[model samples]
Target: MILLDLFHYWVFIAILMMGFYTVIAKQNLIKKLLGLSLFQSAVFLLFIGIAKVDGGTTPILHPSISTEIFSNPLPQVLILTAIVVGISTSALGLAIVVRIKEAYGSIEEDQIQSKDESA
Candidate 1:
């Protein structure tokens, strides 16, 4: 019963772990970047989840609405900034991977390492 109340947190943990595992286990540079994006998405989910409040409304000042509980807008604002940053970062990472592929002739980590060692 208690676990059901915190389902979002569980989902966040699962996604975070999956992303981390992919980052650690995948040998392809593209896969690693995808994993990083997933990791970033999980973090975004966490922040959004934390910002939610039960019986809370948007932080707007109205004359009639007597509700005192209000969800924090700061986290949502920060998450928006983070989302833009994350997209920029992913684009940069993909650009780097493309360059790596062109230079190394392969995107796999092991192959790149072996080639580097031989050269």
Candidate 2:
């Protein structure tokens, strides 16, 4: 059981690292935005996945329902906020990428700056 738990933790960390590295290392503006978005989604997945209590339910409550199957709702609420923020970030990032592409005829940061410097 302990080993299994450790393995799951390692998996999450690995996913996180992969996403982070992509976000940091990508050259294209759109690729970087995609990496950032994936990283955020992985974080939200970790949030929701880890928040599941043992033997928990889907957080719905009804009088007809039953003897205590309540799962945590806080994580769900927080993830909702995260999703909204992610959407806004994606929109902003797309806007920025469009502007950068327009300004330099390319999205690579170095190329864009070089174009600016040359002109």
Candidate 3:
């Protein structure tokens, strides 16, 4: 069972890496940023999935619950923070793209470079 779970995690990580590769390999700035965001979200999902334990409850401090049977909240908290950071990074990236498009009149990074060269 643990091996199966580990396999699932590795599959997700592979997918995430593929997304990263697409981001790096693509010339369109918008497409690259989209791929990057997808990669980051995948990572966040991985973290959340790993934190879940079978038959576990949310990490809540309750009077009846004992320490041995509760789920951990640290990973969730970490993921949440990562989500916010990702959002901010994506927003900043979009803003930069907008500025680049405004200046270059194109969103394709290579095309922009080519046009600049001819000008």
Candidate 4:
């Protein structure tokens, strides 16, 4: 069935929505960051899934394997770079949260906003 073939895509959508919901529904900065990471992971999964090819082999040339499909490696490479960037972004976000906690004494969005309003 088509649904069975696209199962990974469905999983990707589910995780993406969960992460998006967490980011929107959670007030805590840490939780939001975690959700963002989850969202990024889902994107990575989607890309990897797309890069997969049925009955594909590595791109290495082999005369013996004349009839072979090769999966595109570009997406996998780009995802690797994205993963590194995501890690750096997460570290920066965490650092910013720490600074916000230090300055506002709270990481909750509403608390920070109220303090800012009162200031």
- For all candidates in order, the CA lDDT equals 0.94, 0.83, 0.87, 0.94
Where does candidate 1 clash, by residue pair? none
- Sorted by TM-score (best first), the order is 1, 4, 2, 3
lDDT of 1 by residue, 79-117 (tens): 999999999999999999999989999999999999999
Model 3 score (lDDT)? 0.87
Best TM-score among the predictions, by candidate number: 1
Query: How many Å off is the CA of 113 in candidate 1?
Result: 0.9
User: Using alpha carbons, what is the TM-score of model 3?
Assistant: 0.85
TM-score of each: 0.91, 0.87, 0.85, 0.90
lDDT for each residue of candidate 2 in 2-119, tens digit (9 for 90 to 100): 9787665667677777878888998888888888888888788777777788887777777776758577889878999999999999999999899877767899978988887888
lDDT of 2: 0.83
Evaluated against the true structure, the overall lDDT of model 4 is: 0.94
Kindly report which residue pairs in candidate 2 clash with one another: none
Quality of model 1 by C-alpha lDDT: 0.94
For model 3, the superposed segments whose C-alpha errors exceed 4 Å read: 1-3, 64-67
User: Which regions of candidate 2 deviate over 4 angstroms?
Assistant: 6-8
Model 4 agreement with the true structure over 35-109: per-residue lDDT tens digits: 999999999999999997888877678898775799879899999999999999899999999999999999999
